[model samples]
Target: MDPLFEFLLRQGDNTLVLGHRISEWCGKAPVLEEDIALANTALDLIGQTQMWLGYAAEVEGAGRTADDLAFLRDAWDFRNLLLLERPNGDFGHTMMRQFLFDAYQIQNLKALEASSDPRIAEIAVKSGKEATYHLDRSRDTVIALGDGTSESNARMQSALDALWPYAGEMFLADEIDQAMAADHIAPLPLEYRAPWEAAVLPALAAAALKVPQDDFAHQGGKTGRRHSEHLGHMLATMQVLQRSYPGATW
Candidate 1:
């Protein structure tokens, strides 16, 4: 497989899996408004994933469809960073996860907009707008929950603490990333980290949430070295229908 295609699939697969997880919240959010908002966000993410994965398939000259890439692949083949696959424990936890991931995503898409590959750049350009909105809403929710009632504050704080370590994995580059950087198809991972932190810290402070001070940063989850226990359950829910009725689709 071409390195570019591999890179795109990794990106697309991450978004597809995470979007599937978030979509599970569609009718389950605590409030009607939140339910609609999450559903819309999920749709946007899945749409972006489709475009990227489709392009990736073309780039690879593979006969596989985006559905095949998304649903047929086993867990070990997935390359999503650990932060996204964690269970959504509570509304606070979900919003914190969104805030963290969306912050990094916005930075990434903005950089990808200038990619050497025009297809990748175009996808990034289109998705960046949706990502911007996601980041805004998530940031607002983080602020609200972080500064809300004592219970809300405590829960949001705990969410951040639990998720902080996984944040580091977003910036860990491997061979594919090195190829992308060398080809100017993407920016260096480290280049995004400082800006990502700068963008996130003020929001955390505004939320009255203390960023965790843990020195241990989580890594190696991209290659599936560390698996989230929640992932198997998530995959079962996501793939059960396809698994049960092969080639069945509406």
Candidate 2:
């Protein structure tokens, strides 16, 4: 597989999966304002996915559109991070996951703004704007909830402990990362990890959430070798419309 296509899949799939997960909160959010915000964020992520996956399709030259790549592929074909695929256990858990991913994206997208590939740079720039808002919203929510009453604090802490292991995979530099870095198309995991940690650690501390000590990370999402059962379930719902309709449109 072309490294660029693979790289685009990682970017697109992350947003696609995470966007779908976030969308689960659309009508179900705790507050009306929050429901709107969550829906808007989901739209932002799916918009980003369109850009990334559309580029990927062009690169692959396989006559597949972005919608096809997104809705038609099975679980094994996705290359998103494992953390994003985890079920939205609760409001706290969802916010914690969003905060973690937003922090990671903010750092990397800023770096990607300088990518040698103009297409990548353009996508990064546009996505970076939305990402900035996402980080702010998720970070504030994490801090507020984590530092809130006993129940909220405990839930946030639990979410952190559960999701921390998955965070490590975002910084695991594989051969594809190395290749992108070598060509100046993208930075290696290490290149952005420092800033990601810098952004994340202080937030965790402020939230009174204890950062887990474990460095172990579950992998395979980015490689699509294996994904948690949650992803297949998500795809079943997200793809059902397109799959059943077979390119049906207005």
Candidate 3:
């Protein structure tokens, strides 16, 4: 229950889950160019996961490696925000989901790059650059789709409405976050929320997307207490190769 362990795990879990979701589009994207783009973004996320989870393994001082932590954990043990685990409903939904997460993650990483913990800070710097690219891609897609044809606009708006509630979970401050902030290991989740809003709201407005007024945020992933059923299904697929051929590597 170390604060750093939990903090690092949560960071890894978010990228891992979302990356897997994005990877689902490898061959299914709307166009050939988009397919390649989505795949590349997924790779970026998976790479980020390795850095974060690899560090978490070291911090835990346990025998578990990053692969063990990622491929062996049960559903309830994951600490990702719920937004990342939701099924990708459509192209619009996928972009909206990425936009929401990228907003918070980019800000979080920027602050993390200055961490009192040098290891975390180094990882943050590397990952933060990747996040900046992700934000640009997602933001551009959100704006273009939201301001496009009536049908595209409607779909983008719907995606925003469905995904907005989950966004609040990214900013929820629990003891682990408070402790990390107190030690200068990381910023409090709330620290990024306002800037996240500032970046997102203007994008949403430009896209003609309305921000949902609902305050209900589905949480509990950080404490490893709750997860959508989708995560279990994702784990089943993601861990299969590792589980079937334990320790097999190139």
lDDT of each: 0.88, 0.94, 0.92
Backbone clashes under 3 angstroms, per model = 0, 0, 0
The estimated TM-scores of all candidates read: 0.97, 0.98, 0.97
Best of the two (1, 2) by lDDT: 2
lDDT score, candidate 3: 0.92
Superposition error at 100 for model 1 (Å): 0.3
Q: Mind giving the per-residue lDDT tens digits that candidate 2 earns over 114-153?
A: 9999999999999999999999999999999999999999
Report the CA-based lDDT of candidate 2 relative to the real structure.
0.94
Candidate 3 Cα misplacement greater than 4 A, ranges: none
After TM-score superposition, what is the CA distance of residue 61 in candidate 2 from its true location, in Å? 0.8
Question: Candidate 1 — which pairs collide?
Answer: none
lDDT of 3 by residue, 116-150 (tens): 99999999999998899899999999999999999
After superposing candidate 2 on the true structure, give the runs of residues whose Cα lies further than 4 Å from its correct spot: none
Candidate that beats the other on TM-score, 1 or 3, i.e. the better one: 3
Ordering by TM-score? 2, 3, 1
Leading candidate by TM-score: 2
